[model samples]
Target: MRLWLESAVAGTPSWCLYNAVLSVLRATSALIISLLGVSMHGACVSAAGGRLNSRQRFLGSIVVAWALVPVPGRPQDLSRVEQLYEEAQSARTRGDFATAERLYIEVIRRAPELANAYHNLGIVYFMQRKYEGAAEVLEQAIRLDSKLGPAHAMLGLAYYELYRPEKAAKELQAALRLNPSDTNVLIYLGKAELQERDYKAAAKTFEKVAALKPRDPEILYDLSLAYMKLMLESIGRLGEAAPGSHQFWLLLAQDAEARGDEEAAIRNYQQALRVKPDVIGAHYGLGSAYAKIGKYDDAAQEFKKELQISPDDWLALWKLGELALRTDPDQARQYLARAVSLDPDFPQAVLAYGRALARAGKTEKAMEQFQRVVTLAPEEDSVHYHLAHAFRRLGREEEARKELTRFEELAKKKDERTQQMARRLIEMTRAAQPLADEPEPGFSPSRDPTHH
Candidate 1:
């Protein structure tokens, strides 16, 4: 029996059970259960056969001079155990949970080293709504084999149901470490973090789940709550130093916009303006948020407001010109030209000015600005498109064709790249699905313990 377990240990990774249970190595613990203890589920019993042999005595490299092995069970007993295990499973599957529980307990008593028995019994306890019982035995299974990721995950869920967030978090962490792709463990860990009021931790957990499940409304909702809580806490800390300052309201607006609360961002931006009528960037931020929701007219007005105080602000001029282009090409040319004059390197403003010139039938001047745009942003497909139109306006047919063909090629490549990114995101969600790490199947109780 001892030689059999030794051979089993030899066949398995040397540190498999040792590191799985204790997570460390030491001399004394290594001595008593080094081989059999490689698996905590293996037998630790010692006797004459378990004692050290002549080779070890001669080598003088042995501690307690004892070999360890799993307790030998008879073939008939092992056969009966398998039958009982199957019966328990069948009973549990059909909701005869009471009978299942009794049968599982008997199996465990006969084969205490069987981690599967403990794990299945834990499941039966869970089905019976006996959460405490489930936690207790699930932990035993983990103790027997810490590599049992499903046991850890199930234990975490049981702890969550019992309102033990700290324990739940710990077990979920263990499960995740063992199986990082387990979606259930991720969800439970996020919940445990939320219940503990560790919003930052919750956000981290939920964000990973969200990345894995981009369309999951519940994960998104929880993530938003965490973001809001953390932001509020930060705002509170800031408010402590400077209460009701214009900067406070401006910061609030920026935070709201970052969290995707456009309405709140607008409100905070407005409040900033009310607190200090000339608060810098308040109008610009409000305009940006308005633009996000397609309120172009409102956005234009806000940009105009920004220019009232900072008349030479090229960004405000450029934004005002871009917004005006849809409704007032003439107005767009005036602001855009001024914006380009103020900052020649502003590609967007230069492009808008070119477009405005084209709209006003100044094809020659439009060509100059479009050529400058090409120099500044040579790889921009839209620039090529606008330049092609400029060539057409000037009646340069061959040049127009060349530019249009390049535009189409760039656009196609851009579209393919975009589609590739979308496919990657979709594939990410599929890989997020949980996978169970099943044990290898060679070891069995029915295999002759004395065969070695």
Candidate 2:
């Protein structure tokens, strides 16, 4: 029975190592029942009794079907082993670890080469938190059937529980190669990589998980942690490589901007420009910081300086154009035209250019740009709003009304999306509340590996 079951399962088209464990179990059960009689055990058949059942009872069907597959050379001994294996599975499911352990050991004694028996025993040990025993049996399962992805995944998890991150990562990676879509294995691999201080690898692994589950707050949080760790690691390396350099100050300025410290960002940007007068982003960063603080004149001057340094800077052109819209329509048109010419696909720039055209009393030309904006951003409420205003200016009242209605619908959906995002953030905060009492970990630049 053991040999027959193994051959039936292991022979499944290309061995199907990438299949989920449940699918393999189901297929093996179905094939065994189809090829051999269903009533190998009268009790199992009577219990099944052609009635609908829960998943637990459905899983029990494997036991009934497995006992019927003929074994070579030792039919009597193998039938006893099969019965014991089924009993072990039942005990494991019932949470009777002691009985399950004894039955599995007896099954192993009769069928020493049954890799799935070892795998099941490993699962039982794992369920009991006996990581050492689980690891031992899982290793044996892998030795017997090297392509057993579930065993590899379980062994990796066991190794992780044992605090052997290097081994865990290796086995988890092996499992992922066999079953690339296994998010659980990917998660464990990412954690193991993080524990090994391989921030880059951890970030890459977590990014894959995030792609697979974009809306999962937990995965997204872990991905953010990985990216934060990777950033800190790079910052530590950068400090060691070029302390007090313009690039270092530039990085600090950008970090300050992201943290909403406009004053600090301005100071750092100035320092960076002082260090390297022609640095690519220093003028632009300073201009943005000034604009954030409502210093329009200073922002314009800084943006002009950036244009002088990099003549085709589309962002600088767009910012300059936007600033001029309320003051000088002619200057705004020139800047916006150049900005649009440089980056035609930039929806924000295009939208701003349309506004500039509208302010210049070129309603027809403005409508053309609005059409382009609509094509570029059909779902954008602002796009529809501007289009509706243009329609009103053209005296197309019905079209204007339709556009306004579409704008309101889109705006409501946008608000709902924003509310949903806020709810997700709140949920994430609640999930993290238990750790609020924990002391926050500090990063020490001096402890960086790159530091002397």
Candidate 3:
């Protein structure tokens, strides 16, 4: 019986030997049974008998089913799909986005239900700046595998890039539900909120992200921007109460300037400066503000102070040069030249330098500067017009005619009022002669009549 039990436990094919041992044991039954009952060995036999009976019945049924069940008799072939997926992953890991995209597409074609292939394909589209394509691909991935949290998160990013903040919010919210602790998802949701112009929502989302990633400077910067927006909105509402209040005055000045009320803007800017002398923005603002009012000396003074604080401030230099143009051409040229030297790439500076040189009778150099302006800003009609004028001054009639034709083409596309002004200017330029022949009006004849 002991041999039979051992054979059963071991699953050995020794049933004949086990049965012989059992028969021997049963022949000495009186002595063995007396010993088994006297010892704890009988309990072990009872437990083993119960366990073995159940196991033997279960094994017998499985064997019977195995005999009846049909087998394909061949190994399943998934090698093609497996190979393509491996190649896709390898290409993705190697940063060969084009190859990765192709491989992922092939995988999807072979197995359309592959959620991973869709997800990776979305990532490849995002790398290529195809945000709309990424959003579509990621949506398919989400449909195939609802539990794919990262796919939903990437879909949110794609939607945000495509300026579909509403869709982005939904996808990102879903991602957060799937993985509440994902810090990157939290940050993305915050950015989506910002794009939606829901400043309070953005602030709240960012605060949660900041709690998780305390030292992240980009998160802090975004938080600051949201707060700043809220503050500016509040300030805007408050500005309506006290018209002459310093903050209110500044707001009014900015609003007036934006609306093209130059005189009103200048007055408010002056008032704001009187209330607060050390406002850097006000000082810079006042310079342009005074220039609008034709207060060149005052404009020059304010711009000089701005330059003292910020020596390389190009806008201030430009404004000062423009102010000097009306009253002092030599002074204007000096400032404009200084501005060009400070920022070689400033298109406005180049245009202004060309104009100043033209006014100062440096026709050759002025033509070169105007040509440079046209090269830098070919689409700018003003630059083209200026170039035409410079060419006309230099006796380059064909070049001048070509530029004027280009200017007319551009002007025709403009509004009625601008086109009218351009037409008047073109007529004036055509009528005008060289500087040497056109002396300043109201100059007195020499006091010695003999010389005249």
Q: Among these predicted structures, which one has the highest lDDT?
A: 2
lDDT of 3: 0.71
lDDT for model 1 comes to: 0.73
Candidates sorted by TM-score, best first = 2, 1, 3
- TM-score each candidate: 0.58, 0.68, 0.45
Between prediction 1 and prediction 3, the one with superior lDDT is: 1
* Candidate 3 C-alpha lDDT tens digits along 96-191: 889988988987786676677788788778877888888889899889889888788888888988998989988989989998987777887888
lDDT of 1 by residue, 1-452 (tens): 12221121101122235334433324454654554323234333334446445554333333333233223321226667778888887787677989989998998877777777888888778767799999999999898889888788889878988999999999999989988977767987999998888999999999999999999998899999888888788889889988888888888888788779999999999998999998768888889899989999899889898889888978889888877877799989999999999989767778789888988999889889878877876655666656666676677878877876666555555656543433443234235432232111111233211100
Query: TM-score of model 2 relative to the true fold?
Result: 0.68
lDDT of candidate 2 over 192-276, digit per residue (tens):
9888888889889888988888999988887888888888788788989998899888888888987899999999999988889
lDDT of each prediction vs. the true structure? 0.73, 0.74, 0.71
Superposed on all Cα atoms, model 1 deviates from the true structure by an RMSD in Å of: 18.0
* Best model number under TM-score: 2
Candidate 3 ranges with C-alpha deviation above 4 Å: 1-172, 175-197, 200-256, 259-279, 293-298, 305-312, 427-452
